[model samples]
Target: MIEKKITLVPIGDIDDSLLEYISQSIKTTFNLNTHLIPCQDLIGCVPEPVFGGRYNSTTLLKQFHECLPGKIFKLVAITDLDLYSPIFSCFFGEAQLGGCCALISLHRLGQEYYGLVEDKALFLSRCEKEVIHEISHLFGLLHCSDNNCIMYPSNNIIDTDVKSSSFCPSCNSLIERALV
Candidate 1:
């Protein structure tokens, strides 16, 4: 099997278990060697939701690029923002790069959003789905019409809760093909 290295760069302090689940999911699903790196610049990006927030993902990614030369990585910025605020989760989409690089956000992964479901199992499942969905975009998979699929567009917490943690058959096939 052709091995790919997937890196997760944290934008801020987040649950370590969530990070571990991400690494495991990437390895099992995509057969990749995944690494999680905590970036101080990313962590310091916590900005107030009102007015212009300090979190600028594009700027952060550009800064990360300077540190790792020619190393393709996925920088995920996780924050405990009240995503339900009139202010939407400015969480950006995954960007496809030449050397397998991209970025994702964990705005909706907050516990209280899902009815304060602080259970780590539930949190990890939600996190894995979001991370997988974003990573799939880097491989050219668009949003899926299946509501039960992870690739489905989740405009709110209800949508995310309704979706399953696993990809549907079609999406699974697409990912398998990409790996090949």
Candidate 2:
């Protein structure tokens, strides 16, 4: 498999602190070099309005491809803007299953979204789980059966909480073999 640098593309007013935290987590989780590129610099990838106050992730993915760096650097877009796919009611994120270029949204990850007290700790935890999950897909790892695994599919914030930020042993082996 061709391994590449991971790039985090910031979209739509994402906080710098959170992006920094995500960058650190990406390094720690994948043991790979990561870079950041502000979406303000990427032309033609502007967010498009869609149904129910959501942005289309599929379109954003296409934009990611348009500016895809040479040699498959495995770019993932990070945004606070709410995202939705045609197939789902909404998405915390969407990624190519074993392909390059993924996206994640911080919209529904916060307690504030559910009309509860804001919690940075909880928000950050959920964010890391998501970043790891999408990046795992970029690495060609499938949804894991083990609920505790980071690769396990999460349908909602609760499921994201239930899964550990670390990949399970099975996934660890796969990542090692796949990336190392």
Candidate 3:
């Protein structure tokens, strides 16, 4: 497998520190080169959440193709205007251009209920987990049963926080196999 880079497309005005943490986490964990492609227009492309916005993997990928060739494995992360389940929290898809992927963030990633202050560190951790979760999907890994693994689907913020930012042994083994 030719080690490919994961390119991040920043959709809106996401915090700079959050973006830095995300890029660094992926690179450090996977040893994959990562890049951030800034485009203010991405905000217009970002749709409202499913309950509140109409965005899907297909539409988002196409918009990215117009701006980037897909072979490089691109990923887009957007800090949306509203919060939703982690089901709608992140998305990734193969680009028609080549061995590429695109992803978007629905919200900043945290428990925002009950007036609890947003924990920047937790948000960073969630973002790291989600980014790896989606990127692993591109490499053909499924949701794992391990609750502490990043590949586990997070139905709520509690699940999100409970999950670790790295995959469990089984999932990690699968990733190695797929990369082989």
Candidate 3 stretches with Cα past 4 Å from truth are 1-3, 40-54, 65-67, 81-99, 106-108
Candidates 1 and 2: which is better by TM-score?
2
Cα error of candidate 2 at position 31, Å:
1.0
Q: What lDDT does each candidate get? A: 0.62, 0.84, 0.63
Model 1 clashing residue pairs (backbone): 11-42
Each model's total of backbone clashes: 1, 0, 4
**Candidate ordering by lDDT (highest first):** 2, 3, 1
Badly placed stretches (over 4 Å) of model 1 are: 1-3, 40-68, 73-101, 113-117
If both were scored by TM-score, which would come out higher, candidate 1 or candidate 3? 3
Q: What local lDDT score does residue 66 receive in model 3, on the 0 to 100 scale?
A: 61
Question: How well does candidate 1 score on lDDT at residue 116?
Answer: 76
| TM-score to native of every candidate shown | 0.72, 0.91, 0.75
Kindly list the per-residue Cα lDDT of model 2 for residues 91-169, writing each as its tens digit. Answer: 7988887788899999999999999999999999999999999888888999899999998888888889999999799
Q: Which scores better on lDDT, 1 or 2? A: 2
Ranking by TM-score: 2, 3, 1
Residue 98 C-alpha lDDT in model 3 = 26
User: When superposed on Cα atoms, how far off is each prediction in RMSD?
Assistant: 4.4, 2.1, 4.3
**Top-lDDT candidate index:** 2
